[model samples]
Target chain A: MGIFYFVAFLSVFFALMTIFTKNPVHSVLYLVITFFTFTVHYILLNAQFLAVVNFIVYMGAIMVLFLFVLMLLNLNKDTEPMKSTLVKVMGAIAGMCLLATFLGAFRVLEGQNEYVTGNTDVGLVKNLGKVLFDEFLLPFELSSILLLTAMIGAILLAKKETKQG
Target chain B: MEGAFILEKLILVVVVFTVTLVIAMYSTLAERKIAGFMQDRYGPDRAGIFGILQPLCDGGKFFFKEEIIPAGAHKTLFILGPVIAIITACISSAVIPWGQDLVINGRTVSLQVADVNIGVLYVFGVIALGVYGIMLGGWASNNKFSLMGAIRAASQSISYEIGMGLSLIALLMVTETLQLGEIVAQQSGFVNWNIWVQPLGFLIFITCAFAECNRVPFDLPECETELVGGYHTEYSSMKLGLYMFSEYINMFVSSALMATLYFGGYNFPFMYDLGLSQNWITIIGVLVFFLKIFGFIFFFMWIRWTLPRFRYDQLMNLGWKILIPLAIANIVLTGVITLIKDTYFQ
Candidate 1:
């Protein structure tokens, strides 16, 4: 649970860093970190399949393409990056205040009931299949259509634009 | 069964992280050895006794090294990229069942850290997100080569994922289960191996695995001859190490998957008939699972040395035109067979 919190915090911190960076490259890097932490979060949630898929599709595949695109464009370091010492200082103060307030309200942690760790039967692949086919079938089919559209969109965009001139 | 407290899960999570990190350390050693042999040379012989301690030495070197921030880089992403890559690799093994229950002192203990249902789908969803880490690293590096590598990785993964998923659908249709343990259980004998029943699906899976793991022929993004170490070109020290190590770790996971889904994970011939105690059976199951994983890892290394890579379009063609349709046909054929057997034979 502590590790989960750590991962969540890292995810938030990196996500913010990714957004705040003036350098696009830095933004991408932090985003990568964000994805990684999210993978950890997925693992904590007992989503083994989700965690690995995160690596395969997101980190290994998508991120690599993102890097290639960035490199091809050569969007090197930002000329003048955003956020300064003054802004950072103010942010720190705001963050600490938020943290303190949250801590002040965290006494509810003691009153929370525990959750029993149950058998592995529930999370097994069989039950998941049933759920997907029975409950999630429509969404699943819709997503397939969405994916097809995305594939076509990517292909169309990637096609070579002729030099009319 | 334990008390319903975060403590059990918390400890389990920590254990998973630690085990993954440990596996990461050894996988480095395996890569070196395989690479060394491929080149027809002795590999890492100088470290502690047959390079058994090479990873430790490497770890020492990385730790002792200086962390240099590139003068013009986005310092934040530069720091974050490696962390993302490493952590993503480490956390992807959570749902993989190491074996059946470990029965000790008249009690049963499960070998897997967590048994979340929807395990397969969860693996897919998480893998889909992992591409972001590489994307960020390349973008953060602010280098042309790194970004190109990342882009290549992203497109390659996205392109093949459809086929990969489609390939698995047939297996899902057959097993009707998403639990990895159940899959293993279903394939509990040599004859029951899904590889025989779902040969085409297995073929698609193995092919997609090479791409998923970014191995050669499909290793275009990281092809040194072309992209110069691909996305991690600008990365050095532990960050670079994380990118490299994650590849092998992913392969490890994929191996476990290949074994579990097709080869009957942890189910050796006559595994049940051994008449061993449940505890012994559990231990044996874990051993069998690791054996299968190692065999796959070896196959990965072996193939890396044997095959040249496919051009990008060719790779896409294989996944889209070849694999997807083939998987669909296989599913249809299997359905027909099952129907015929159910109706006529019965």
Candidate 2:
């Protein structure tokens, strides 16, 4: 439990740092660290499969893509256009609104902390697979279709740009 | 009792750590020696008997060498890069089942450090993290060449990983378990090895493994004639050594994984016929596991010296167009065959 709090604090710290970092590359690295802390949280929750998957998919693959593009663009602090005070103030106002919304939603669910459990094998691969294949098969298959469509769309867009250029 | 258990685990961890470092260190010497022998010359026979002490000399040199960070480089990331590389490399050995089990003082101890149910997934996750080391090093160098090399490495590793994971799916279908120890137990004898059942998957796996390890024919990221040491171009001293060391360690771990997944890890034929005691059997099993690992390492070196590096486009095409489809087909075929056997033959 103590370890969990430590990791949680680090995750939130890194999450904030990701946004506030001056360098884009450093921001991406901090985001990767944030994802790693989330992975640690998953392990603590006894969802080892999800933890590993989160590490592989988020920290490993997606963050590499993020870093790759950031590096390729070669954006530095010097080249970054300064935002006006009005724009910064509006951004903070919008962030505050989102935080208030989240707090209100949590407040509505605050009294529903009753621990009810059965078939506690939720995170194990075998149980997850059974649940997905048996109960949520339609949604699972639809999600795959959505991913496939997105992939094809990306390829087509890339190919068309290459041909035009 | 708990203290004893903790002590045992500590000893095992230390032993595994030492063994991994020793193997990686020697692999550098062996790679050079093999390369030299292929070119008809003696390789590093100056230090000690047949250059046995060459790794020590190399380590000493790295320690004494002047460390440099480029003027415009990201200092924090430059240091973090190699540290990430070596840490990821070392942590990967945790899931591998080095041997069956050892009995000491009337207690049985598993050879593996962690026997997590999702062993294969853990290995995959570690392999995936490996790209960051190269990518960060290259990007932090603030050099265009280094950046390009890192980009190449990231794409290459990501591309190959797809095929590798796809090939592994077929093996998983056959074994029906993700635990490395369970997979080995299933292949108790020579005849029961997954290689016989899924030869095509093994072929795809080995090809992807070559790409994953950044060996010849797939080493475009760091090809000397092209990117000038690739991601490590701006690195010097022990930082550079760490990158190189991590590569060798990656090779060692990958070889051990391949031996475990496909080649019946720590299993020997006719062990029961020999009627050896359980302890002796385990000892032999551990020795056999090392033998298999060494065999795969030698194979890696042999191919490195023999094959020419693939053109970048050709490498990408092979990874995506050829290997991925082949692995998918292998998985489908395995599924169909398993279905037929269960429905008709059974």
Candidate 3:
């Protein structure tokens, strides 16, 4: 539980640092760290497959793409335009309101029976594969088809644009 | 009793760590010696007999050399780059089954560090993370050449990783498991090895592995004639040494992985008939595993010296157009074969 809290703290801290950092590259690096901490949380929950997938997909591939774009754009603090104080104040207020909404939702759940947790094997690859294939097969297949279509569309659009240029 | 168990695990970890370092160190020497021999010349025999102590000399040279950080470089990320590189390289060994279990005092101790169920995926994850070290180092160098090299490396790795994963999928289809130890156990005899069954898959896998390691002829990222030392151009002293060392370590780990995945790992023919004790059998298995890994390492070095470096566009084309499609075809072939076998033979 202590390790959980420490990891949670790190996740939140790095998430904030992702936004607060002046350099875009540093911000991306911080975001990667945030994702890494979340991976740790997944491991703690015994979802080793999910943890490894999260590490590979998000922190590895996605973040590398993010860093690639950031490096190419060459964005720095000096080039960043400043926001108005009014905008900052309004953003803070909006954030606080969202936090209040989340807290209220949790408060409503506090009086109910505590969350049930067992069957740790559910997170294992074999069990997860069985559930995904047996129960959620249709939805899984449908989602994969959707992703494939999106990928093809993206490729076609990019190719057309390049040819015209 | 738990304390003893933990102590055993700790000792295994330490041993694995030291062995990886020693192998990586010698790999450099072997690479040089082999390269020289191939070119009809004597290699570094100055440091010790057969230049065995060359790695030590290299280590001392790195330590005594002056460290440099470019004025415009990001100080923190610059240092973090090599640290990330070496850490990712070292951690990859955790999932590899070094040998069969050693039985002592009625306790069976596995040679691997962590027998994670998703062993293959863990290796993939660590290899994928390896790009960060090169990318970060290159970007932080604040040099155009370094940035270009980093981009090349990142793109090349990402592209080849697709082919590598696809090739592995065919093997996984055959084995029906992701655990490294389980995969090894399944291939107990010479004929049971996955290589004979999925030869095309092995070819594609080994090709992608070469590209993923940024080795020749796929080493476009650090093409010395073009990139001026590539990502490590601005690096000096031990930071540079760490990056170089990490590459060799990555090679060692990848060789071990290839051996484990396709070459039957620590298995030998008719070992049970020899009438050896379990511990002795396991010891022989470990030795055989090392022999396979060393063979693969030597293969890597041989190809490095023999093949000419790929042109950047040629590398990309081979990765995406050739290797990826070949891997996908291997998967289809494996599936068809498996279906036919199940329907007719069973």
Candidate 4:
């Protein structure tokens, strides 16, 4: 329980830091830490496969790509556009409204929240594989197809604009 | 019992850590000596007989040299780069099965530090994380060449990782387990090695391993004629040593992985027929595993000296077009064959 609270605190803190940091590279680094905390959470849930996949796909590959782009762009304080006073005031107003909505929702659901204490071993690879293949087969296949389509779309967009007659 | 278990694991961790570091240190000397032999010259023989003490001298030099951080560099991440590199390198060894269990005073002690169920994916994750060290060091250097090298490395690693994963999937189908110890156990006699079954997968895997390690033929990230010392351009002293040292460690780890995966780790021919005791068998198995690791290391160096580095376009094409497709085909083939055998032979 203590470990869960500490990790939760770290995730929220790093997520906030990701938004607040001035440097783009540092912001991405903070986001990486946020993802790492999520990985820890998955491990705490006894989902080792999910934790490792999250580590590899998010923190490893996706974050590297993020840093790669940021490095290439070489953005600095000088290049950052100054925001108008009106925009800042508008942003703060929007944030306060969102917070109010969250608080109201939590108030409504206060006593109804329930902890899920089910079969913990369902997260193990063998059990997870069986569940995914037997019960969730359609969704699993659909997700792979979706990913393939997205990949093809990316390749098309990245292709050179060929000269036409 | 719990205290003894903890102590046993602690001691195993220390031994594995020291062995990894020593092998990495010697690999540096071995690489240079191999390079010299290939080029028809004597390599660093003055440090000791056959340059045995050369790595120690190199370590001393790195320590004595002045450390430098560029004025424009990110101070925090500039120091964090090599530290991450060395940490990720050392941690990957935790799941590797060094040998069969050794009984010490009737306490059956496993040679592996941790036999995690997802050992293979853990290795993959660690290898994927390795690029951060290069990318961070390069970007933080605040040099154009460094940034270029870092970008190249990131793309190369990302590209090769897919093929590596696919090839492993084929091997997994054959072995039917994710545990490294189980995989090694499944390959018990001479004829049951994975290489014989999945030759194409092994080829794709070894090629990707070379790319992952940034060895010769896939070493465009550190190409000297370009990039100017690559990602470590602005690094000085032991910081620079850490980067180079981590590469050798990565090499050692990769070689061990290949041996364990395809070449039958810690398993030898006709071992059961020799009538040896369990303790002797375990001892010999450990030695055999190290021998296989050394052989793979020599092969890495041999290729490094023989082959010229690949062009960036060539590297990308081989990774995406050739290796990935081949790996996928190998997976399909393995699946079909397994299905047919199950139906017909049963």
Candidate 5:
């Protein structure tokens, strides 16, 4: 649909702005806008839960953290480390490689894009919950456990540093 | 039919918007009056009877005041901050059901703006996004005090939101749906209210609501003693007014949310026993709902006046250590009890 393309374009544009912005805080703000576009995209796809979760987690919490760190860093042009030509060339090479891989992957899956077809209600909470719990329960629980482990590790590291100091 | 539906929703949205603004406006006066009452002094009674026209005068003062932008401030974001604040504060009212449906000329008009399936989450997301307004405002000012205030706000909101979400999870389990209308509908009679069921969850929720709204006990973001007006240190005139006004608006929305979630919103004790018409019931329900909202708003002011502000560390500890654990335990307890009730009692 036209609305979908417009939102998609907005997402891409904001994502580019996030990367290209000179100021770190402005970059994070652009990233927040990018995340908002993703939320809109989820709504367009009828994934109400996904849309709200993206809005809260990404735009609200994560972006705030990003901006917080940037604000504390107080990065400006005078303080920024200048990149050498070699580093710049390498970065461009890496970026182009990433682009090539993404394009190739899309080309490979060009005809196999059937995951979201013919099911307007698939993204609704009830159906999504049923599928996640009944079919993908293992992966779901495993992901949660991974997050829990990371959280515990971080807390332990923090405690150890406090005791050492 | 389509045109009528659109018109009806437009009217509802306009009504809800106006009511929210009006309540936020009067809440300023009410808060001061209540503070005066607590201090055993006459409040602002000079404007009109009991200072009824005080809010209008205050609005005029704010508009007439000279606006200032700091020389070092980021110009764009400085303006964007309060704009985002007030807009987010107002939009959260869209999903709140003010009363039961009113049937006029055989057309049933729901009292809510949108009966979206994710109504609860929508409110949660909007409220969560409210921190950006403060953060942006504080950071853009390019002042150390403002930046500190912004940082405190960011951490405070993040910490409290977890407890809030966990508390809501317990309520969601009991209601078995995220739809606000459905949740209200389930608690029709007096005894069916969720407050009696999830008392601990309600406590955690109200505490987090206070923190999320940046009220008295959790109001480190704008503590006047050390930071000098905190995040709005460099803000002036109506821009500063927007920040303050948005806080009151947030209070109104959260109070409405509390009434809707726990108090059996718009559902009185025994409506059917009175044999009133549906229209009359709807009308009375709207009045009753507003009464509940006012009660909660008063409670907000009461706590604000009564309690001292929490130390930053104490606030963080209360949020993360106390409230989060209690909320998680409440969810677990709700789950186990529900399972037991279904298997054995039922």
Candidate 6:
């Protein structure tokens, strides 16, 4: 329990530091650290696959791309969107309210035992593939469509104008 | 959970880390030597006979050199850049299974630090994060060249990553497991190496590996004449050293990955044929693993000096127009073949 708490505390601290850091590059880098600590959390939870995926997609691909964008923009100045103390306090209050509401709602709910998974095969790669391809065929196909739209959107946005225009 | 187990894990981790670090360090020497020999010149003959101590000397130089944070650079980010790079590059090895588990004194010890079901994915994930090191270092350097280099790296890495992931899909389909150990286990005996079954995947894997490591032919990001030191343009001393060292380290990791994935990891010809003792078997396993790693490393260095880099437009075209589509086709072909084999051949 103590070990778990220690990891959780470190995770939260690093995450807060990531967002609070002034330099965008530093912030992105810290976010990488935060993602790593999350992997640690995932390890503690025995969700090895999630941890690895987190490392690959969030830390490796996404954050690096973010840092690249930050570099391209040359956003080294101290002027990028640092909220005032009053704004921070107000945001904190609103955040707490949202948290309280969510907890209160989940607490009051009486139908919570809807899904109990005593099965160990729940997270296996084989099981995941079966479920994804078989049971979720519609959504899976829909996602392909979504991806196709995104590709077309990107191409449309990036296409250069002709001289005749 | 006992002190003994903790100590054992510690010893294993330290041994693995040191071996990896040493290999990476020597890879730099090997790279220079290859380049020197290729150019018909001496590589390094000073600092211990035949420059054996060259790596150590280079480390000393990096340590002694002044740590210069350029004026107008983000001070904190400037420092954080290399630290992130080195640490990320180092720790990504955690999930890699060095060899099979060894049992001693009634304790069953696994070769890996973490035997998560998603071992392969974890490797991918950790490597993905590695790009940030280069990205951050370049951005924080506050140089146009650095920024340009960073953009090139980011684009190149992400572009190649699609092919990398796609190439692995065939392997995943074949093995039906994401654990690196299980992957190796499935390929235990001879004739089962993935290189044979998934030849196209293997080719794609090798090409993507080269791109992922930013080596020659895919090294548009840091082509010297073009980008002027690329991402590390403004870096000096140890900061620059870290960027360069991390590349070699990344190369080492990728080499280990290639060995582990395509080759039968640590299962050389005739290891069990001798029927050696446990400790001796472990030693042989580790040695064989290193031999394979060094072989791959030598290949990496040989190619680095041998091949010229691809043009930027050509590199992008290769990734998107060619590799991604081929990777998808490979996956489809692999799936169909597997289905056919299972349905009829089996």
- Best candidate per TM-score, number? 5
- Candidate 1 matches the true fold with a TM-score of 0.74
Could you tell me which residue pairs clash in candidate 4?
Answer: none
Checking candidate 2 for backbone clashes, the offending pairs are none
Local accuracy of candidate 2 as per-residue lDDT tens digits, B1-346: 8998898889999999999999999999999999999999999999999999999999999999999999999899889999989999999999999887888878999888999989999999999998899999998898888998999999999999999999999999999999998999998879998889989999999999899888887988788898888899999999999999999999999999999999999998987789888889999999999999999999999999898889999999999999999999998999999999999999
Measured over all alpha carbons after superposition, the RMSD of each candidate to the real structure, in angstroms, is: 8.5, 2.4, 2.7, 2.5, 1.6, 3.7
Could you give the candidate ranking by DockQ, starting with the highest? 5, 4, 2, 3, 6, 1
**Residue-by-residue lDDT tens digits, candidate 6, B1-346:** 6998788879878987897788888888888888899999999978898889999999889889987888977777777778878887888788777887787776778787776678788777767766777777777788888878878988998998989999998888898888888888777656888888888898888888899888887877688898898888888898888888888889999888888899877776666678787667666776787788889888988888888878999999999999999999999999999999999998
TM-score of the second chain for every model: 0.93, 0.99, 0.99, 0.99, 0.99, 0.96
lDDT per residue, candidate 5, B1-346, as tens digits? 9999999999988888898899999999999999999999989999999999999999999999999999999999999999999999999989988889899999998998898999999999999899999999999999999999999999999999999999999999999999999999999979999999999999999999999999998899999998999999999999999999999999999999999999988998997789999999999999999999999999999999999999999998999899999999999999999999999998
lDDT of each: 0.77, 0.91, 0.92, 0.93, 0.93, 0.81
Compose the digit string of candidate 4's lDDT tens values, residues B130-201. 999999999898889888888999999999999999999999999989999999998886898999999999
Question: Candidate 4, residues A1-165: lDDT per residue as tens digits?
Answer: 999999999999999999999999999999999999999999999989989999999988999999988899899999888999999999999999999999999888776633235677777789889989998899999999999999999999999989857
What is the Cα-based lDDT of residue B73 in candidate 1? 69
Instruction: For each candidate, give its TM-score against the true structure.
Output: 0.74, 0.95, 0.94, 0.95, 0.97, 0.87
Off by over 4 Å in 6: A1-45, A76-121, A161-165, B103-109, B275-281
Candidates' DockQ values? 0.28, 0.74, 0.74, 0.77, 0.83, 0.65
Q: Quote model 1's TM-score for chain B.
A: 0.93
lDDT of 3 by residue, B215-250 (tens): 889887788999999989999999999999999999
| Best prediction by DockQ | 5
- RMSD (Cα, Å) of candidate 4? 2.5
Q: lDDT score, residue B170, model 2?
A: 95
Regions more than 4 Å wrong, model 2 = A81-119, A161-165
User: Worst ten-residue run, lDDT, model 2 chain A?
Assistant: A112-121
| Error of model 6, residue A105, in angstroms | 7.9
> What is the fnat of model 3 with respect to the true interface contacts?
0.71
Candidate 2 chain B has its poorest 10 consecutive residues by lDDT at B212-221
C-alpha lDDT (0 to 100) for residue B183 of candidate 1:
85
